[model samples]
Target: MPSEWDTHTSVTATGDGLFGAELDPGWVVGGGVNGGYLLGILGRAVAESVPAKPHPLSVSAYYLSASTPGPAQVSTRVLREGGSVATVAAELGQEGVTRITALATYGDLRAMHGDVATTAEEPALPPIEECVPGTMAPEEVRRIAPLMERFDIRFDPACVGWAMGAPSGNGLIQGWFRMADGHDVDPVGLLMVCDALPPVTFDLGLPGWAPTLELTVHVRAVPTPGWLKVSHRTRNVAGGMFEEDCEVWDSAGRLVAQSRQLAMQPRR
Candidate 1:
């Protein structure tokens, strides 16, 4: 049996470079569908269009409007297919309105082998058991954000203060995460998990829907099966917008994915 993530992110090719998909309401957060989940839909479309490229090396997406649970259309166009990679343009449309536009570079992870050097270290986190429940949103939060239940997220207790009306006044949030349904993480899933956490604004005492404007993800390595250590940090917030950077490290201590996103500041 396929995992829920696969079941929901699944897509069917229509014709003329178009694909049809369904947005699962369970993945809805705040007022619309989770951005990461939406990316999964788009990513799947591009992946299938270029079957030789089984993994996404990099993906950049611009969210034009909020997406809701319903039928969605994905239109894809292959831009370039080369010896090592393939580039594809894809978009998600709903209710006749285009909600997202993306460009993705796909390649085979198994075929990737090159020099890699990194000075960045994984975010410090206590054992998962010592962390707080990262899946349960408060009643007020639950009313608007039900997507948390789809994951097994154990947050570092220090950065989770906003859940109790108190924030750490910092821009860092760290946690361990995996699909609650036990779906193993993959390159496509990396696109989703990289943006799975609560907005960075929540750690700064700003509680509201922080809609993403743009998100770019680079998949590093195929993650070894285990809980993923995820961290999100923002050092800049201005002009009613903020930029957050995220890192996802596998249990083996390998950097599996890196992402940066620009989003609106929360307004209640």
Candidate 2:
């Protein structure tokens, strides 16, 4: 049986350079669909359209309009195809209205080699078993958002105190993440995991839907198999707008993906 994420991201060729995917309501966050999940659909379309089975290197997505649960069409155009890298543009639409536009670069990671260096260190986190699991009651899931049920997230207890009326006063969240159905993390799966966490603003006592205006993700390497260690933080909030930075490290401690997004703060 396919996991919810797999089933939702699956696309079928509908025509030349065109594909279609069904948007599941289970992927919704608030009244709008989750941005990352929507991007996954486009990523699949682009990956299938290209001759080489290249992994996504970088993806920049702009939310042109909001979409509800339904069928979505993807139109992909290969901007450039090089010996090592390919650039593609994709648009996701519903009922002939464009909802999201994306530009992505893809390449074979195994063929690339360089002197890898990074000053950033992965945050120390407890074992997944020791962390506090993010679970909601049945009624709460119905009231807030059902998307939480699709992910297996074990959050740092210290960072989730705000849910109990205890604000941490710092906009930071660290956790272990995996699909509820135990699917392996792939490039498309990494995209969904990048945005799966609760907004960092939740710890700042701002609890409402924070719609992403734009999101950009860079895939550093293909993830190693296992649960992913993730962290999200927000350092700035002004004029009802804020930015969230997310880092996803595979079980082998390699940074698989990193994302940054600008979002509107909840209007209280």
Candidate 3:
């Protein structure tokens, strides 16, 4: 059986056909679930809960309340089912408070066209073996590097050159990463995970401590590449508020997803 961290450990079905899972503390931060991991767990939960075929392509989530530590309860409800798509709403809570809510949509097929926005061709995926190990704090690197157990990554010096170093006045990160499990997962889930990295980048900027306040992802497609490149940048920070944005690309150099986050920095 997958451990609590690998996947949801305990879940129950409701009379209304919704499903709920107890959230584990290993996944929570600031008394709320890590926004990125929550999206992953819930995205996978919804995918497992329903009979949809193509897998979740998009998800939009709202953070309503802070999730308390320890086992949290998750409830999923089917909002709509259509000929080619399905939609679900998920609520995660603890202590009688709804902490997080999400709406996920899945589709069977997407229109493919030759014409779309394109960017300067990014460099080829670098050899993971040749790239230097990331320089993030031991704990943070341990936390995120393990995530690569689920995704394949080839660090690009130009993009992710100094990821662990202090964030320059500009919060920017560039790199390549993809599902290490060797399968395309929900695009939204990809965005959710991708968005999580910037907070660490932002924190690195401070001489002390900083925590994330909000993260948002906008997925453009189900990434088809075995590898993806990222260009993440933070545009502003003022009065305890900071913002970062990430632009991700498929191996083919097509824009695949983008993410943005707002955070509060407190002196450590």
Candidate 4:
């Protein structure tokens, strides 16, 4: 059985470099489809355009507006199809309105193996049993953000204070992430995982929804079949805007993905 992430993000060719996709309601957050889920939809179309290079090595997406659950069109243009990597530009639109535009470089992760260097350390976390469930949200928030139900996200104890009305004021979130349905997370799934956690601003005592304005992710390696350790932190916040840095480490202790996004502070 295909995973929900795969099933919902699937795209079908409708000719003219445009693929048909559906925005599943289950992936909605803050009255709009989760940006990561939307990114997956667009990335899938770009992948289909260049099947030889299936993995998204790097992707930068700009959100122009929110998208609702319904039929969506993903149109892609091959910017540069190279031997090792393919660069493509894409747009995800609904009802003739473009909601998100993206550019991506795709490559085969299996074919890349080289030197590894690490200066930054992955956030150390206790066993999943000791962490708090990310799905433990207030009724109102859970009602508007069903995306939480799609994954088994266990937050680091030190990071759960935000949810309990006692934010840590540290602007950091650490957690263990994996599909609740037992499906293996692939390179593309990293898009969703990168943005799966609550915005780090929540722990900084910022309330309400923080919508992403732009997101960029780099896929470093394919994940092993197990849980992924995710950490997101924000070091600056000003002018009602902030930047978030995210890292995902696979079960094999390999760095698989990294992301950074700029978003608005919650309207609250």
Candidate 5:
């Protein structure tokens, strides 16, 4: 329950190449770098280095080894910048060994012809204000509440309630969120938060330990939603690995992003 940042080494910026950060305690089952956020971090690093206004729309990261939260580096290389899309390749390494390789694409929206569809009618979930705030585990509450405070989260107790033994059904969850500080919540920032949540969903029914191994996200737009709704459901779990898929929607129920993850299950 220590600080997420405190548990890890400081992030360093290498002026010559890529930025690097390290995680402390190396790697644990459910405590590794959230995969979704890793993709976002790599994607942001790539898009920010470019002169174009387009942001990364898709990110794919392969886990080469256990990403320890101690000291790691992210190196980015621009692969191609065409008339429409820019492709980037990134590698994260620790102690001279590659840990993750990521490829990302950035593009600007210029009005394309495509069929726009909507998600089916979903029942209105509880409001964040009405949902109970963290109070049970003081250490965990101390750690995550500040982080949540940074983002405007309209949480559904029905989703997180199970962690407190409230009988949260299966691996189904819904919630709304946006950056609370009013910073430009780009796709990468959005992805970071997305990858951080599925572990909770996957651990809903388990009596003990869980950790995410890898996460991949496909983003469609910059996502300027006043409220971003997330619907997460577990697809399958086998051979000590689990997968959870989620769809992200705007306040008006417009689909904006999609994500999937694979994690290792470790029992206490």
Candidate 6:
């Protein structure tokens, strides 16, 4: 079975600097299309436009408006192209209304190297089998957000007490994540996985929709083939807004991707 992401990210070149893709209904969250998925589509256009630099180094997406399931068009404009790196600006639209605008820098990951230092430690997470499935009953999910069914996610038991009516009071969620269809993680897939987890504010007993206003992801390295260990946390929530920081570590213990997003708090 093809992964939902594979199907959705597949785009056809329609014309010069223009591409078309059909957004899958399964990629919806709270009646709006997933921001990361939209970014993946935009990244595809950027990558194809600049074939010399295929890997996304950093992508910054700003959600202009909400989008629904349908055929969307991506228009790309190459901003800069160097021997080692390329930058592109792209937009995603449906029915002639633009929904997302993004600026992305792409390059060959193999040609990049630098002294890497990190004070951040990977969060401890139990084995996938030992963690709690980050999903509701199938029937409930089917009616609410069928998109979630496309991912295999297992959340840290300690941070999931909110689901059991015991709020942890800390905005942190750690988990193991992978495609339900078992697709290997690629650079494009890494973009989607970075935002796959439920909002960190969920553990703080906030529920509903936490719509992302802006999201920026940095692809650190190519991911090894295996489940990704993910950690998402929010340090502050004020004035109906919050910021989430996420880290994606491949099974080989490599930091593959890191992201931060500004999103609205759940409205009750």
Q: Give one digit per residue, the lDDT tens place, for model 6 in 1-268.
A: 7766767798899999999999888888877977888888888888899998989999999888999998999999999998899999999999899998899999988778997777778779987788998565356545667777888889889988877778798899888888888888788778888788778888889877898999999998888999999999999899989999999998888888999999999986
Compose the digit string of candidate 3's lDDT tens values, residues 1-268: 4433445434566545455666555544433456677666666667656655345666666777665446556677778887667788887666668766877776543543356766645545467666544433367554633433444455555444344553453455555565544554446456455654435344345533244555556566767746566665666768877766667777656677666666666564
**lDDT for model 6, on a 0 to 1 scale?**
0.87
Segments of candidate 5 deviating more than 4 angstroms: 1-17, 20-31, 65-72, 110-113, 120-123, 134-152, 180-184, 198-203, 207-209
Q: Which is superior by TM-score, 1 or 3?
A: 1
Task: Write down the TM-score for model 4.
Answer: 0.98
The digit string of per-residue lDDT tens for model 2 on 79-183 reads 999788899999999999999999999887767798768777896888778888877424664555778878889988778887787869799988899888888
Q: What is the TM-score of each candidate against the true structure?
A: 0.97, 0.95, 0.69, 0.98, 0.75, 0.95
lDDT of each: 0.92, 0.86, 0.58, 0.91, 0.61, 0.87
The alpha-carbon deviation from the true structure for residue 226 of candidate 1, after best TM-score superposition, in angstroms, is: 0.8
Better of 5 and 6 by lDDT: 6
lDDT of 4 at 196: 88
Sort the candidates on lDDT, descending order.
1, 4, 6, 2, 5, 3
Q: What is the C-alpha lDDT profile of model 5 across 56-142, one tens digit per residue?
A: 577777777656456667788888887777888888777888877877777764433468765555436676577544333357543
Q: Count clashing residue pairs in model 5.
A: 12
Which one wins by TM-score: 2 or 4? Answer: 4
Model 4 lDDT per residue over 148-178, tens place: 8898989999988988899999999999999
Worst 10 residues of 6 by lDDT: 134-143
State the weakest 10-residue window (summed lDDT) of model 5.
2-11
Off by over 4 Å in 3: 1-17, 22-33, 48-50, 53-57, 64-70, 80-87, 109-114, 119-130, 135-166, 178-188, 198-204, 207-214, 266-268
True-vs-predicted CA distance for residue 202, candidate 5, Å: 5.1
Better of 3 and 6 by TM-score: 6
Q: 1 or 6, which is superior by lDDT?
A: 1
Report RMSD for candidate 6.
1.5
